[model samples]
Target chain A: MHRIERYYDSIFTKQSPEQLARDIMKKADSSAKKRSFRPLAVVAAAAVVLVGGVTAAAATGLLNINELFGGRISTQDEQFAGELVGAAQDFQWTTSDDDYVINLKGVTGSERDMLLLYEIARADGRPVTEYMTNIPEDGELDCAENLGFDLNAGAFKAGNYRYHYSINDDGNIDVYNLAVTDGDISGQQFYAEVINLYPKQLLSDFEAKHDIFDWAGGADTPAGFYRWGDNEAFDAGQPCDVALNDERIIGLELEWTIEFTYSPSDTAKLSKVITDEKSVVSLNYEKSYGGVWTYPLLRITDSYFSSVSGRIDLVREGYMRGQTFDTCNDIYLLLENGDKISCTAFTGVSSYDRHEKMSSFSVEIQYSEELNGPITAVDISKVEAISINGEVFSLI
Target chain B: MQGDEFTQYVRKYSDMVYRVAYSCTHSAPDSEDIMQDVLLKLYICEKKFHDDEHVKAWLIRVAVNRSRDVLRSVNKKRTEELQEGLSVSDEEPSSDLHTAMAGLSRDHRLVIYLFYYEGYSVKEISKILRITESNVKTRLKRAREKLRAFLNDE
Candidate 1:
C-alpha cells in the first residue's frame, strides 16, 4: 500500500469490519420487516408535542425572526444583483401632466428575485440638480419606507416597498435599480407608481455615511409625493414624464412587460441511452438562446416514474477557468402513467475533443428512489434549447 | 447480495470505502456512517455488476455522494457530534508526506488520495467524481504543487 493510503487506513482501522457488517445487516433486517401500528401511534404523538412546542416558542417571542426566516438577513449589499443590469429590458415612459422623463432602462433577475433599472430626469433639457438641504447631514434616508409622500406633512409617509439603490459615480442618479425579492414577473406587465423623488446627492450621502440602509423606516424630509393623476395612461415603451412642484423635470413612471424564452442549439432534442459493461450512459443535447440561463437538465426514470442514476454532457471547458457559460436548457421524463419528473445532471468530467472541435463532457445523474420497473425508453422529446440567434428548438 | 456473498464483499472493500469516506469528511464517525449507507445501497441496488472493478467504482461514487450529503445537511447537532467524535493527533502521520497530504483542501486531497494513494487513473477519477478529465488533471497538478511547496517550507 502507498504511504498516504497506509496512514488513512490506520486512522480508520478502529472500526472492525465484522462488527460493522453485522450492525449494517441488523439495520437492514429490521427495516425490511413490516412497520407496526404502535410505532406509528408513537410518531404521531411525538409530532403533536413538537407542534405544541413550536407554537409556544413563537408566542413567547423565543423564536428569532431571522432564524424563522432561515437566517437569510445579511448586513451586506447584495452581490451578483448587478449582473442583471446588462440583461435588463429597456423602456421609456413620460408623465402626461408634469412631462417628467422616466426611462425604464432594463429588467434582470431570476424567477423569484428581480432587479429593475430606471432613470428619472427633466423633460426641458435641464439637470435635476436640487439636493434636499433641510435634513441633518448625519441623517440617512430610508428609500423603501419613503415610497408614499405626505404633502401636508412635508415628508414621506410609511409604506412597504422592499427595494434598494446604488448611486452612479457621476453623482447623477442615472439608474434607480430596484431589487424586487418576490413573485415571478416573467411574461408579465407591471406599473411602478412615481409617488416621490428625493435628490440624488441626498440619497447618495445618506447611503455613503450609513453604509447600510434600513428597509423599514420613513425618510423625514420636505420632499412631497407627486400625485400623478394619470397612473393608468402609462405603458411600456411610451415616452412620458411627470412634473413635480414648479420644476419642468421629467421623472420616469416606469412600465415594462418581460418575456423569457429558451431556444437551445439545433441538436437539442437528439438523445440516446446506451448500456455498456460497466453502466448505462444517456446522451442529451441542450442550449439556451438568451436571457437568464437556467441549467440544461436530463432526468432518468424507470417505468414507475422513479428516478435512476444518469448524467448529461453539458460541461463547458472555460467554466473552471473563470469563464462564464450559459446553462439554460430544460429536459424531463414522461412516465407511462402520464406524469413528468424533472431531471438533473451531476457535475462530470469535461474535455476538449480535438477531432470534433468542441468541448466534450458527461455528467452522472443520481436518483435515490428505487424503481418498481425497468426504464422503457430514453426521452429527449421534452428538451427546449433557445439559440443565441433567436431560434427556438423543441422536441415534439 | 445476500448471506455469505454480501459478507465477503464487505470484507473485501470495507477498508477502501472507509478510507475514501474519511478523506472527504475528515471525521471518523461520519465516514463510518457513510460507509454503512454505501454498503446498504449496494445491498438494495438491483443493477448487475460486471466485475470487482465495477463494484469498487460504484461503491466509491456512492460513498463520495453520501459524504457530501452529510456535510451539507442543515442539522447543527450533527456538526457538533462530528467535532467531538474526530480529532487529529501528531502521531497520526509518521512522515512529512502524510502531513502535507492532510493540509490540502478537501477537493485537492480527495483527488490526490484517489490518484496517488488508491491508484486510480485521472480518467477513472473523473467518472467517479462526476467531473471532467481536464478538471481532474488540473486538480492533481495543483495538489502536487501544494505538496511540494509544503515539503520545501518544512
Candidate 2:
C-alpha cells in the first residue's frame, strides 16, 4: 500500500463504527429536551476569582488567540499579540458564578484599543455544547444575542459585540472581546468586568432606563454585574455588580467580573499602527436579497493594511435582511510582480438588525490555506487595486 | 425502517460518510455532527435506491453538500485535533506522511483520499464530489505534488 494510504488507515481503523451508530440511534430515539426557564438572581450564586497569571499557555497547551482572532487579524498582526504573551502582569483570574467558569486569559492592547481575552466553561465539566445546542459548528454559540462589558480603563469604553467562541480540546469556551478607545491607557489598573450577557431587545430597554451608557469613572450607583430585566432598575446595558431577580439569559449563565491590570508599553513598543484615509474609494453593487435588488454602497471609511493582514473599516448603505457576505470576503491584493494574493479568512463584525440606515464594520482579513488560489502573506507595498467580489478599487 | 435496519445501514457506511465529511471540514467534531445528520436524513428520507452502491453514493453526496453548508455558514477554520473521545490502537503508525497529508488543502485532500485510498477513479470522484472530471484529476495531481514537496522538505 502507498505510505499516505497506510498512514490514514491506521488512524481510521481506530474508529468504532458500531459505537457511532449506537450514539446516533440514541439521539434519534431520545425525545427533544424540555426547555427550562429559570430566572436569574435566585439561582444560588457562588462567584469567585481565581487569579492565575498569563502562564495559561505554560499551563495550557496554547493560548488559542489565533483561533479567536481568525480572519480578523493578519499574521503580522499576530506578532503584536505574541509580544504580550507570557508578559501579562496581573491578568487571568477565574470567575465562577453557579454553572460556568469564566477565565480571563490575558489583556492586550495598542495605544488605540485593548483586548480582554477570556474563556468560559461549565463548572461541572460537562460540554457547554450539550446546553448551548443551537450552534454546534466548531462548538460556537452566541448564548446571549448581545453582550456588554465595562473595563474601568480611563477614556476607554468597551462595547460587547456578538460573542465569538469555540470549544477547545479541554472543553472550555474562549470568548473574544476587543474594545476600541482613544488615548494611551498605559500603566492602567483596569477592574475589567464582563458585566452582562443578554439580548439586544433588553439592550434598548436598559439604555432607555439608565439614559447613560457607562458609569462615570468612579460612580458607585450600580456597583457590578446584574441580571437583566430582573430589577428593571438594574443596568442591563452597562456593567453592574448585583443580581436582583428575573431570568432573561438562558445559557452560559451569569455575568463575569474579573480584575486584571494591563501595561501595553512592552507589547506596543514594536507594534506597527498604519492608517490610510488619504485614498477614498467606494464600490456599488446591486445587492440581491429575496429576489429584490437594492443598490448598496460600499465605502472604505478607514483602513490599515499590513503585508500579511489588515483591517478595513467600511460604511455600507442599502440594508437587506440576511446579508451573507463580509466586507473583506473575496478580496485580493495585486502584488508588485503582477502576482495576486488572496484575503484568505475574515471575521466581520456588524449589528444584527441594521436595516435601512447605514451600517459600518471594520473587518480583519488574513490568509489561511482554505482558499483555492494564489494565496500568500500579503505584501502590501505592491502595485495595488483592492478587489471586492470582482470590482477593483485602485490603491495606487 | 426497523430499529436494527437503521443501525445496520449506519454501521455499514459510518466510516465512509465520516471520512467524506472529515475531508471537507478537517474538523472531527463537525465531521461527527455531519455524520449523524446525514445518517438521520437517510433514515427518514423517502427516496429509494437501486442497491448498496447507490445508497453509498447518495450518502457521499449528502455528506459533501452538508459539509459545504457548514463551511459557508462560517468562514473560520476549526480545531485540528483528532477527536479526543475516539479509542485508538496503541500501535497506530506514526509517520511524516500523516503530517504532510494534513497540510494539503481540503479539495486536494479529498481527491487524494478517494483516488488512492478508496480506489475511486477520476470519473467516479468527479461524480461523487459534483465537480468536473478534469477538476478531480487536477486536484489529484496538485495533491500528489504537494505531498511530495512536503515530504522532500523533511
Candidate 3:
C-alpha cells in the first residue's frame, strides 16, 4: 500500500453495517410518523389560537433587558453566583474610542464563571436605531449579532450572549457570560474590548444570503478561543464574585495571568511487547475510570484485531468507529496439560486510531477456576469479526 | 429511495458520510449525530439518484453541511479532547498523525481527507463542497505542505 493510503486507512474505521441499518430504520420510522402528524397538529393549533385571543405581542420602543434575558442562566453561572459572599453591585466604568462609547454596567457570577454587563453606544450620541431596526420584530437577534468571545490563549470555548437596548434610550446593552473550565480565573482582572461591530446593513445582507445558524464551512469564527486585540476598546475591570443578579460594575486596571492547572496523567505502562514485520503489540495495565479499577491495555500496531490475547489475558470485546461490540463470549485458558478453564467477568478496553491503522485494547478478566500449570497462547477464534477496508473476517 | 433501496443506500454510503463528518467535527458523538441526521435526510429526500456515485456525492454534501452546522452552534465548545477516553496508541506515526491533523485547520483537514482518503477528484470535491475547483486544488496543496511541515517538525 502507498504510505499516505495506509495512513488514511488507519484513521477511518468502517462502521458496522448491521447496526447502522437498525439505527437508520428506527429514525426513518419516527420521522415518517412525525411528518404525518404535523399537518393535523397545525390545524389543531390554529383552532385553539383563534378561540383564545393569543396574539403575538408587538415590538416596543426601548428594548427591555430583563425581557430579553428571559431569566435563563446557565448552570455554571448559577454556581459562580452562589460562591461569592459579598459581590459589589454599584460600580460603573466607561471608555470610548472614536467610533463608540463602551460602558461597563456591572460584573457578576463567580471566579469559575462570570457575567459582564455592558453597553455600546455610538460616539455621536445617536440612538443605535440602525442596529435595533435590523433586529427581528420578535426581538430575536440574528446569528450576525451573536458576538463570540475570542481568547488569545488559542483554547477553544463557547459562551452565552443576552442583550437588549438600554432602558435610558442609549445604545445596546448586552450581558456576556465568560466561563473558564480548564483553567483558573479567580479574582483576576483583565481588559476586555469589543472587537467587531457589524453594521446593520451588512449583517442583514449576510443573514439574507445564507442560513445564519448553519455553521457548515460558512461561519469561520472560532467558537470559544479568544484572539487578543481583536476588539480594540481599552476597557479594564475587576469582576466580582457575586450573584448574577448583581448589577454593580467595578472599574480597575489590574494585570492578571490566566494559569491552567488541568493535566492528564499516563495511566498505563507497557507490560509485554511483541514486534513483528507488520505490527507491534504491547500489553499494558492501567488504573482508569476514577482509579477504582485497573484495566489491561493493549496497543496493536498494524492491522485491526477482531480479538487479541496475551499468555494470561484475553480480549472479549471490540470497538470500531465509536461503537462497542461483545465479539467474544466464552473464552478458555489453555494450560500445558491440555485442559481449559472458563473465563468470567471479561471487560475489554479497545482503542483504535484509524489514521495509523493501530488498535489498542486491554481486557480485564477473571477465571472461574484457579490454574495450577503454565499456559500457552490465548485462543481467539471465537471472536465475532474483525474489519479492515470494509471487509469482515470471522475469527472462528 | 424507499424501503429496501434506502437500506441499501445507507449500507453503501453511511461510512463515507461518517468519515467526512468525523474529519470535520473530530468528535465521535458529534459525528454520529451528523451521520444520523444525514442518513435521515437521505431517507426522506424526494430526490432520485441516478447511480451510486450521485448518491454518494449527495450524502457527502449533506454530511459536510450538517457537520458545519454542529461546529457553528453556540454549544460547539468541546472541553474534552477526542482521545481522552482511549489509551494512546503504541505506533509513533498513528499518534503523530493524529496530532498533526489536529494542528491543521479544519478546512485543511477536510480537503485532504476528501482528496486522499475518499479518493475524490478535485472537480468532484469542488462540487461536493460547493467551492471552485481551483479552491479545492489550492486547499489540497496547502494541506499537503502543512502536513509535511508538521511531520518534519515532529
Candidate 4:
C-alpha cells in the first residue's frame, strides 16, 4: 500500500533462487571449515581446559572435582568447550555497601545484549547525584555477550537493556551501579528520587514538553506552566507596587519571606517565608473587588438583580484559567505558624442603600527576606462610592 | 534425522531464509551467506524439523539475525548495500519504489518485507519477529503510511 513497503517487497521478492542456493553453499563450506579449525592455545593448555570444564560440568552438580580433572578428555568436546568460553572479564562482579545498595541482573537472547542494575542510595544522600553506569556498569561490563546474557526484546525496542552490579570496599561506604548494557536505559525511568532523570535511548524521539516542573504527578499538576507577576499581581486598573530584596546573597538553598496589604474593605493581605531548603515555596493571594452596583429598569437583560448592593467580591478563577469565577468578600490568611491574619479596613469604609456606596482605595506590600523572589506582599486600597438611579452618592 | 533429510530441509527453505536475510541486509550476497550459515547451524545443532513450518520459521529467524550481525560489522560495506539497486533519478529508468524503500527505517522495512514478500499476516510476522502482534500491525501501518508519503511527494 505504501510506496516504501511496496518497494521493499518488490526488491525482496526479486531475490533469485539461484543466488540464494549459491550463497547457502558458500556459507555451509565456511561453517564446515571453521568447525574443523583448532587453535594452538587449546593444544598447549591441557590443564586450563580441565579446570575450566569443571565449573559447568555437572548439570545439577554430580561431578567431583578430582574425577572431573582426572577423566579422559574427548578431543571434539574440548574443542567445542574452547569455542564456548568467553573472556575473563565476562564473569567479573562488583560489590556495593553502606546505606546505599546496587544490584545487577543480566538478560539473554537479544539482538543487542545488556547488563542492568537497580541502584538505591541513602535518603539523606545530600544534593544526591547518581551516575547510571559508574565503574563496572559501563564499557565492557555493559556488553550482554560478555555477561553471558541475552535480552528478550531486541535492543532497539525494549525501553532499555540494564544489568545490576554493586561495589563494596569493606568499609561503611558503598556505591551502586545499575550496570547498563548500553546507554540504552536512563536511570530515572526505574529509579525514583534520582537527582535528574531524562529518557535517553529507546524511543528517544518522543520529546517531552518543557517549562512546567513536575510539582505534583497529575494532569492538573503545576508542570508545563510558567510563573509570572514580576512576580506580583495588581487590581486591573491600578499601579502595582514591586520591590525586590536583593540584599541577601541568593543561593539555591536560600530562604525568604513576603507580605502584602491593601485598602477600602477591598483588600488582600498575604505573607510567606521559606522554611527549608528544597522545600516547595507556595504563595497565597486574596483579592476583593469592592464597588457599587445599580439596577436599570430600562435594560431588561440587566434585571437579573432587582437592586444593587455595595460589596467587595474576591474573584478566584480556580486553579487554572477559564474556569467560572468564585466571588468572596472575605479572605482569611493562613500563616506558617498556624496564626491567621484577617484583613480589616484601616480607615475608609463604604455602604449602599440597596443602590450606591463606597470610597477611596489603595494597595500596599510587605515582604520577609526569608523567602526567594521579590514583592512578597501586595495590598489594595480604594475609595468607596455609589450610583443610585442616575444619582451619585458616597458612604464612609 | 539423517544428513539427507537435513539437506532436503535446507533446499526447501533456502529461498524463504534468503528473503528474510535480504530484508535485514538489503544485499543479495549477505542474504545468501546467511541462508547457508543458518542451514549449517541447523545441521550441527541436530535440530530436527518437526514440520515444514517450524523449520522454515527457524531458518528465517537465524538468517535474518545473522545477516543483521554481518551488516552491523561492516560499516562501509553496509551503506553500500543500503544504496545498491534502490535509487531512481528523474530521467533514468529505475524503480522509485526501491528508492523509497531504501529510505525506510529497519523496522518498517522488515515489516514490509515480511508482509508482502514472505506473505506473512501481521500475526505471523509478530510471532516470527518475536514482537507483540500490535507492534507488528503498527509497524506495518506506519511503513505503508511512509511509503504513501514518499510516493505522493514524487
- lDDT winner among the candidates? 2
The alpha-carbon RMSD over the true interface for every model, in angstroms, is 16.8, 11.9, 15.7, 14.5
lDDT string for model 2 (A135-220, tens) is 22221114321223423222122222222444465545565656453333232112233433322222332332233322321211
| Tens-digit lDDT track of model 1 for A21-133 | 78778887777673553688767875565333211000000111112112222212122322333443445554332434545666655534444555544465443222211
Q: Lowest-lDDT window of 10 residues in candidate 3 chain B?
A: B83-92
Q: What is the TM-score of chain A alone in each candidate?
A: 0.23, 0.27, 0.22, 0.17
Q: Is the docking of candidate 3 incorrect, acceptable, medium or high quality?
A: incorrect
Q: What are the models' TM-scores?
A: 0.36, 0.33, 0.37, 0.36
TM-score, chain B, each candidate? 0.85, 0.84, 0.88, 0.80
Q: Lowest summed lDDT over 10 consecutive residues: which window, candidate 1 chain B?
A: B80-89
TM-score-better candidate, 1 vs 2: 1
Model 4, span A128-215: residue lDDT tens: 1221121111011111111111111111112332333222222111222222323323211111111111112100111111122432
Query: Candidate 2 regions off by >4 Å?
Result: A13-15, A31-396, B73-93
- lDDT (Cα, tens digit) per residue for candidate 1, span B130-152: 45454576566567778889888
The DockQ figures for the candidates are 0.12, 0.14, 0.10, 0.07
* TM-score of candidate 2 on Cα atoms, chains taken together: 0.33
Worst 10 residues of 4 chain A by lDDT: A246-255
TM-score of the first chain of model 1: 0.23
Clashes of each: 37, 8, 19, 63
